[model samples]
Target: MGTPTPPPSAAKIRRTSSSGGSGSIILEKYQLGRLLGRGSFAKVYLARLLDNPSAPEVAIKVIDKAATVDAAMEPRIVREVSAMRRLHHHSNILTLHEVMATKTKIYLVMELAPGGELFAKLARSRRFSESTARRYFHQLISALRFCHQNGVFHRDIKPQNLLLDQNGLLKITDFGLSALSEQKIDGLVRTACGTPAYTAPEVISRKGYDAEKADAWSCGVLLYVFLVGSLPFDDGNLSNMYRAMHRRAFEFPDFVSKSAKIVIYRLLDPNPNTRLSLDELIKLSWFKKSFSQENLRSQGSDENPTGSEFLDSKQFKFMPRVNAFDLISMSSGLDLSGLFEEETTSSKEIRFTSKMEVAEIEEKVSKAGLEFQYRVERRKGGAMRLVKGRAVVVVEIWGVAPELWLVELRLVDGAAELGESQWGELRLGIGAIMAQ
Candidate 1:
């Protein structure tokens, strides 16, 4: 895999020159206009690509190094960029065109969404009807499914992250905390991350939890917010919030649909193991019904409607292509491996390989019950090294014949083989293996 480009420095902060009474211009791409908004760590600007003058305008987000207090966040930012660059989907997710870095900031040129945030709309309306909520929920689920399938988990899923284009289409944005689903850590996400109102119980407990399941809980909170103008578990005190979440105590308004309520309950299950998986959510009756309706609506006369006709249409046109040369020029030396590091041995050796294949050993041990864990390393020559540890082979004699069984095979000390046990049946699967 290629390395990510370095972020910008603090000295590179440039003010945007106001054309009229507007603010200072930060980044200047060909034909792109001016800056729009500023966040804690980044700034967004309205810009147009030079190559496609007539193309729709895009919103470029620039992450200023000066604003990033935590040096640890730099890797996370790079990971977000790399992930976004690889993702290309249509259902309301922000389209990342190109990424560039100046001396002071990392710039992400993205498709400018015109409609603003769903938070603003929800605030204005105080809440949405069941049908409207269902529509938005369906869109959110679809986008999440795409991310999940690609091994991404948007740890922050709230109304604020949901941006709407001029055509009123909702798109997911702000992937700062997003990471691959398979990511593992010793403890829960330490950073008291995410909007407090949407945070899951496990997050507050400071216990390490699955990012995917945490995301699902947040989605459930978002659903509740869309349907009822407020969070399900909100109180004046932080302790109250934790208490409510711990008890899984949240009331559904009488107006909420039974089907929608069912979905929310499943998603908000306190036990991550019992929580509705993404696959299961996609198969729910509510999702099926809502998705079918959305498809019908899209196929009907509403097809190809402009931004003015629908509040959800994309207001600005996105540039078809981004200039990689420009990006490389702006970026300095970046450490790509810093963002994605696999588990290493005691010597801290980094293995870089494309594939690993494990061959089946030739030995038939009687099989009754089997449980084993092995560490498989991908060699440079496209081969796999299965480092097994201990194997417990047991033979039980029944009324008729003796049954052989393998209890637990702990692959820790070193590679070990079962003596006359079923080595052939102990086949290993190949893939990226993290020791930790």
Candidate 2:
């Protein structure tokens, strides 16, 4: 088979430029610009690939490994890459281009979300019309359906994590707090994660809870916020917040349309068992009218049983639209991935499949100034670690089927946060840095 064709989105890019920080030379491939955003462990920068200006500007997340106060966060940092790689193909999910690393830092190159955070959008608009709100909610539901189908649970779902592209499309970002269904103990996620305001009652209770239900509850909170311009369950005290959520104590403003109220009530249903499913929500008169086939895709209606060439035709108005929702809410909702599901799927675990020689790989690392420490053989492939002033760089290579090879770069300490000079040199030595 020939090389796979990339999505049209891969070709869309924002503006790009470069600036000197501390009078140092910038990386050649990426012309680094201004700082975009920052958190405790990472800082995002606006960067453009020199070879492809037509391609969208990438968001480079520079992760400072040595800055981590807790050793436990290390695993979670690595897990973010695995989670994004699997979830990248969806229209509503963030896209990760590559993850490169040094001994002390890890670099994440991702899609630029020029429209900014959905929260900022909400703040600016104050509130949305019922018609406008329905459009955004339809997109959110589509994203969630995809995650649940793939067995990934975004435990955190709030406006803050939801981003909007220039087209006003929803893009789900942060995965640091998410958990895969397979990782649960006894089909129950025991940890309490997510912002308190958006968290479900069961999740904040500290008792083991269903991941699907917890996320649904959060989604409901977002809907309410989108329509009301404020959170449904806000309070100064933590105890008060939990009390309100447990009892479903919030009230709707007079302006909220009757149809919207119906969906909100069911979405915030205190009982997870009775909460509305994706099918039921789309079937509502409000959704059907505003969220027709033209406006959005249904997670539960992929087969298009009617075989109608015009799925979005208004002619179906009097033809009983119930089947459309029923189809979407099937055992598994409609899939937007279509027959191209293989294009979206990627392995989360690290494995090597490069044709490059091992000796050449070692020579590159040595030439980059990382002092070779030692190498040890494992059952399948050996491992090696290099050091330079308390910084640690780990190299893991393994053999796979049909005589394929792969190499992985892991940043340990001091070296993880590379100076502009070191990062540039290391990139040249790393042979075919592959994304798993």
Candidate 3:
């Protein structure tokens, strides 16, 4: 068979010209201008790709190595870049053009979304009208369905992550927490990681939760925030917020349309199994008639329209097709098997001398499912000095017959593993294991 056709290239917009000189050398090509925003570990700068002079202006995210405290975060960053590179959808999702790295920093060149964040817009407008909410919801669901169909779970889906183009189309960005489902894992993933306010109850409870379901819950929270201008569950304490989530203690505003309310209720269901599937969500009556055909056409006709316009249009339909090995190639370079190898050589063995610190232990265990109890041990003069060593957690899920599955979570100063009885408890994490 012939090679598949590549997706259409992104539209190019004129960039501001830069003067040539020694100081202008770096600024001439990338033209890294003023800092637009700063996050915990990174800073975003307005930039231009001089190689493609006519190409639209873009934003460059510079992740400082000195600022990143977590060693485990590097793999997650790589995974996000790889996933974005593989995705070629035409939604408002921010497109990653290239990844550049240096000894001190990593740079991500992305499309510059000028319309600002959806959160800012919401804050200014207080709450969106049903008609307005429906318009945005239609676009959001379409983008999310595209993500799910491609096996991508955008773990972070708050309004802050949503961007708007000049034409007022919403674009989803910030894939720091994104992961490909095909990545190898010890059995099931039990990590309780996500923004607490929008996190699903199952995730906060440390239950084995589906990433897709967790994403759906966040979407539900987003819809609620849009219509009501507040979180469904908020409290001074994290535990209290979690409790409220478990009890389903939240009220929908009276202004919400019946159809929108129905969809939100289904999306926020505690049971992942019962939550509205992306396919079903896209087919809902409200989504079907959310925006008029004229509105969609008008958005698409803009000179530099947001990709969401195309996604919301009938021309952009998501058709599910099964291809067994598509995800396999995406994770080719990641050697997870090495992580499972047991220490055979005497030099590889390390003796534990001290009990792991409770705070450090909690951080690692927090990522695991609550069904398992993790035990940490400090190794003497291994990776680091015993006094300043790291910790590792070995997790084994329970109830699976035959061979037991194991996962190791490493932290500074010690290591921990799931208790023997906890073996086989992870469903999705174990499902990620592939045959050699």
- Angstrom error of the Cα, residue 73, model 3: value is 3.0
* TM-score of every candidate: 0.64, 0.64, 0.62
Report the C-alpha lDDT of model 2 over 37-61, residue by residue, as the tens digit: 8888788888776666666676778
- Return the top candidate by lDDT: 2
What is the lDDT for 62 in model 3?
73
In candidate 1, what residue range of length 10 has the lowest lDDT sum?
396-405
RMSD of each: 14.2, 17.7, 16.6
What's the C-alpha lDDT at position 176 in model 3? Answer: 68
For candidate 1, the TM-score is: 0.64
lDDT tens string, model 3, 301-355? 3322223433432122221111111111112223222222333111212111113
Judge candidate 3 against the unseen true structure and give its global Cα lDDT, from 0 to 1: 0.55
Q: Candidate 2 — worst ten consecutive residues by lDDT sum?
A: 319-328
- Cα error, residue 338 of model 1, in Å, equals 7.8
